[model samples]
Target chain A: MGEGMIQDQSDEDLMKAVAKANQSAFRTLVNRHMGRANTIAMRSLPRREDAEEAVQDSFCKIWVNAASFDPDKAKFMTWFVRILTNTCLDKIRSNPPRAGDIDALADVLADDAASYDAQYGQKREGEAIRKAVQTLPDRQRMAVILCYFEEMTNPQAAEVLGINVKALEGLLVRARRDLKGRLGAGEDNDG
Target chain B: MTDDDLKKRLRAWTVPAPDSGLADRIVMNALRHPQKMPWSLRLGKTLETWLLDWNAGAIYKCASLAMIVVIGLSIGYSSPYAGGADTISIVDLAMGGMNEWEGS
Candidate 1:
């Protein structure tokens, strides 16, 4: 198939082709989802290099397990998020963050802020938030990343975490309460 | 911080866009490992589960062994020379293809 046609194919269809060991289809899938995967990893992990490594590992896993994926059980993004999230968690546990890892996450924020001029106070606030986020427990931090940072719906986030909506809501409530204590007052009823 | 305030704060913490060559690197690394076909994966899973199943009674074990033996015999009997004109009996081979054993 032409590149355009392959690009136009649905993720499930592309996954089916990937199951047959089609490199083009795999490339297409990777290009389509790489940014989101990177974003999730960056939000979850402490260092940029670790986040990138986690993302790479996750995509490699997706390729290796493409045959076992069943779309009927879950959507492609949901499954991908699950894999990416777990990969990040495993990376974190295997190599716990060093003392100055907070600087690394702040450095990523600083790099992002560099594009805008004279946003010094904003940059500081961003760094504070980033550090506070990193201090959260693994699951709570994930809940914050998916719901608050990524703006994913509660049900979708719950599905990605393999939990029911009620349990996810509990996580979000606790996350927000903890963040409130760490950074100041905050009440988010949507969670 | 209110809900909107927290959301704004969270949004301020931005992740840099991945480098231009990131996707290429990931694709190259992943392609080094070939994926298994769906059928083969299923077969592997089935065999793994069967091998790991330790709850079978003696009857099941006997039945499995009998089935294997039957399959082996069937494959042996289906060979090209099993009943062909070239077939040779054990006695004939022992006597060097003679009708009876030669006296030594």
Candidate 2:
């Protein structure tokens, strides 16, 4: 059993272990995906405290629902990000911001900068990229976070967003175009 | 910049490390509540498994009983002396007595 376990410790394995109440295996999974999960939450909610809460809530849900995971349908991270994204979206819709709320916008930008600093040691360029990402529409932003930031494939991102792959591709295209526009880069400019 | 380049740069942005206690807190919360598996689901699974086992056992028993019945019926039908020879002795006895009386 030990040999078999050593040979086959995929996310699925860890999840099964989690279902059996294995704390070590659960911790391993959290360590592996927590950073990306946090990023997705932060991108969607654009606030540190809320994002952190969302991540924690999502992980908790995952722990509870580990037995329901279907490996054939989606990878573990894809499933996980879907939960995180939904939690963030629920938070957003529950309290829709007023039109032209500059304070809200500034708070979002400041949160992004602070999160980046917390993660990457104060890179101005990183903050700029995040600010640009913040300009994307919600769905487009989600697609980008899942596709690029989380390193998920288009189909996986689409699954997380409950959209078709073609739609996901379009969202990604528009998101990239928007990012390029806001970052002062032209169609020819290659970062 | 090209879209690919912009995407690449955006991808390069890193997420800062979360709060040091975040994982512990999440794990602790999970341990505390531990999603309750619904009784209905548990009952359904149990019933499904039991039904499968019962169906297989019933099928085997029914097939065995059928084979036994078939073999018993075949043996009974193929026996030549089953119900045919019992009255033959009485008929022979009566015929012999009649023949003797006629001869006397």
Candidate 3:
């Protein structure tokens, strides 16, 4: 199929073509989802390099395991998110974040600072939110990242986390509560 | 903060966009490493995970080892006598095929 034609196919269909080792279909899928995958990885991981590696590894896995994917069980993005999230979690476990490591989110803020000089207050608020997020327990951090940052639904986030919806809700509630307390304290200190 | 406010604040922590070359790099990496895992290996991983979950990993390993030993022994014993004919007669070789060796 032509590149444009391949691009038009759904992710699930593209996966089928990928199962046959069709490079065009695989490339299309990669181009379509790489940014989202990177964002998810960046949120979960502390370092930019690690996040990039995790995204690469996750896509490689998708290519390798395309034949095993069952669209009936879940949408392609859902399956992909499960793989991406697990990859990130495994990376986190092996090399737990160090206190002094430069965070990828900070880099984002710094880049924003240069481009949007007028949004100084927003930049600081963003920094505070990032710090508060990093302080959350791993699962809770992930819950907030997926639901709030990525905008996944409760069921979708729960599926990615391998928990029931109720459990996922509990995580989000506790996570938000913790963030409220931390961010509020930051504000109080600033004032 | 209210839930809506918290959500809004969370959005402020935007991730940096992925680098322009990321897709090309990932595609190139996949091309270079053309081989993905075979289904058998994936199935093995799934089985291993299941076994570990139930804390039966040690038992699974022992069972696998025992099976290997049993299969090896069975194959060794079965192949030697499978033809039902003596390929090498030790007594004949010793006697040099002499039925009556009435030596001096």
Candidate 4:
């Protein structure tokens, strides 16, 4: 199909084309979702190499399992996020992030003391929040990532996690508490 | 910091852009190594690959030996022709000497 023609199709149509080894469809899908995938991976893994590997592995899985996608079960982003999240989680499980690694990453992200970055304080807070998030138990981290960072609704996030909505809410509650305890934040919004 | 402040910071913190070639790289890698269908079959294939080093031939040999031992015992103890000297011995069955019984 022509590039313009392929661009006119929806994600589900693109995925079906991908199942048939349509490289153009696959490229379109990659272009469509790569940024979100990169953000999820970069946030979760916090290291360039691991995050890159996770995203690559996820897209690879998506390519292979395109045919298995049941639209009734999940939208394309949900399914894709689930894969990316699982890949990041696997990376997390295998290579438990060290404290020094987090600090080093924060320093790297901090970058350039001389660059009059007005959001320096905000950036620092972001790093601290990420650090606190890192300290969370794996499931709690996932809950925060999906519900908060990815901005998924409770049911949608739960669907991706393969957990019930109630359980997912429970995770979020506990996660908020954990983050509160660790960061001295989340007071008014503790619910 | 206020809760909203933290939330705003969370929203604002975007990781720097990764390499421009990433999407292309991912697509190429995926095309090169397409996923297999039906997880169960893939799992079975993976298990087969992993367990290939366990010497399955030895297992088959052991199973054959067990069957031979069972047949030997059944035939020796449960012979139907107990009184006839012309009845084939267990040795005849073992050594393919049952042709003599056919002649008789």
On TM-score, the stronger of 2 and 4 is 4
Q: Candidate 2 clashing pairs?
A: A119-B16, A119-B17, A185-B1, A186-B1, A189-B1, A189-B2, A191-B5
In TM-score terms, candidate 2 sits at: 0.65
TM-score of each: 0.73, 0.65, 0.74, 0.72
Best by DockQ: 1
Docking quality band of candidate 2, CAPRI definitions: acceptable
| Residue B21 in model 3: lDDT | 95
lDDT string, candidate 2, A1-191, tens digits:
35446345898878877777777777777877888788777767656777898888888888888777778877887788788888887877775434443235444446655746554333445656666776577889889888787778887888899999999999988887788677775323534
Q: Please give, for residues A1-191, the per-residue lDDT of candidate 3 as tens digits.
A: 89889989999999989988899999999999998999888878878899999999998888878878889999999999999999988999999988855454566566767667667677777778878988788899899989998899999999989999999999999999999999989989999
Q: DockQ of each candidate's interface versus the true one?
A: 0.45, 0.34, 0.35, 0.35
Q: Interface RMSD values for the candidates, listed in order? A: 1.4, 2.3, 1.8, 2.1
Pull out the clashing pairs in model 4.
Answer: A64-B35
After superposing candidate 3 on the true structure, give the runs of residues whose Cα lies further than 4 Å from its correct spot: A102-117, B34-104
Better of 1 and 3 by DockQ: 1
> Candidate 4 lDDT (Cα, whole model)?
0.80
True contacts kept of 3: 0.58
Candidate 1: segments with Cα more than 4 A from true spot = A105-117, A185-191, B37-41, B44-104
What's the C-alpha lDDT at position B96 in model 2? 100
Candidate 4 CAPRI-style tier: acceptable
Q: Candidate 1 chain B, which ten residues in sequence have the lowest lDDT sum?
A: B83-92
